[model samples]
Target: MQRKEALDILHSKLKKKNLVKHSLACEIGMKRIAEYLGEDADLWGLAGLLHDIDYEEIEDAEEHGKKGASFLKGKLDDKVVKAIERHTGYIEPKSTMDIALYALDPLTGLIIAAMLMHPSKTLAEIDTKFVLKKFKQKGFARGANREQILACEKISIPLDDFVNIVLKAMQEINEELTG
Candidate 1:
């Protein structure tokens, strides 16, 4: 399916505003990482954008990735579905692209949390150090899933570096993100 079609499907399936925002953040984050790594940005963005398409249908955290992969069986390509499937951190990310998605899947939520807590209440106002500190805090966005963010190390990029890269990209598109 086309990107817009996929987005429409995602929007229809996701009801929570915060969830939708997180999906978009992942999309943008993955897209930037893909560009940095000389991969297909569109494909990466779509993978990130549709990663949680089945979250509502599969409430069990253990089965969410598998369910999402199955849900996109005939809707998207195999690679895209694989990206969604492995995004949950249940399995080790085997590719740079997979690592990118895994890293940002939870990092995006943490960044958003940091942005919301900032005085400016914007992505641009979020500092990399602040986000890194938040990552170490057990009480800050507890569900941000540090395990997934730590997967960034598999790609040779430390967690702080990964967060900075994603946050910078998001800052450039903050208007589109928060608008």
Candidate 2:
């Protein structure tokens, strides 16, 4: 399916505005990472955009990616479905997209939390240095998994460069993200 159709499904299921924004951020993150790694940006971005599609609908957290994967089996590429399933830690990450999603997902949350804490309260105000500092504070953005984000190393992307790429990609979507 195309992005418009994927977005339609996302909007229909996710009532919370923040979740939609999060998905959008993930889309940007996936695309940016793919570009950096010379992967298929469209396919990876689709996986990121739909990774949490079942979050609001699934009662059990364990079923999050599985449900979304099942729903998307016929619609999306098998690789995309697998990436979505792997994203929630429902399964071990096996592909490049899977590993990237597992890491990038929580980093997006961390970035947003950092933006909210910034004096300017804008994506533009947050830089890699500032984010790295916030990242070191365990109490800040506790939901963001430092360990998972560090998984970028498995794909040969250092934490600093990974964060920089994702952050820049997010900056491009500032309005939709902060809205």
Candidate 3:
């Protein structure tokens, strides 16, 4: 499906503004990471955009990805659905795109949490160092799985570089995220 159609479906499924912003943030991260890895940005962005499409409707956190994939079965590419399925860690990521969505899924939340803690409460004020420090702190954004964020290194992206890439991507869409 087209980006517009995917977004329409996302809006239809998710009523929480925060969840939508988080998906948008993930979309930005996925797109930038795809460009960095010389992959298809649009496809990666779509996977990230709809990764958590069923978050509100699914009561089980472990089932979110699977159910979302089922919800998007024919409307999106099979690869996109598979990537979304793998994002929940229910299955191992087999493709570079899948690895990216897996790695980015939680890092976006950690970065956003770090940005909120910043004195400026803006992406511009946060950096890789701050985010890394937060990453090491188990208490900070406990919901953002550090193990998942560390998965970026498996794809050959160092933690610092991964943090920087995601940070820049999210920064570009700061207005939309924070608004």
Which one wins on lDDT?
Answer: 2
> TM-score for all predictions?
0.90, 0.98, 0.96
Identify the runs in model 2 with alpha carbons over 4 angstroms from their true place: none
The CA lDDT of each predicted structure is 0.83, 0.93, 0.90
Q: Find the candidate with the highest TM-score and give its number.
A: 2
- Off by more than 4 A, model 1: none
lDDT for each residue of candidate 3 in 1-179, tens digit (9 for 90 to 100): 78899899889988999999999999989999989989889988999999998898888777879999998888888999999998978888888778889989999989988988999998878889999999999898999999988889889999899999999999898899998
lDDT value for candidate 2? 0.93
lDDT of 3 at 167: 92
Prediction 3 global C-alpha lDDT: 0.90
lDDT of 1 by residue, 16-96 (tens): 877787788888888888887788889888998899988888867878778878888888778888888888877656777
Clashing pairs in 3: none
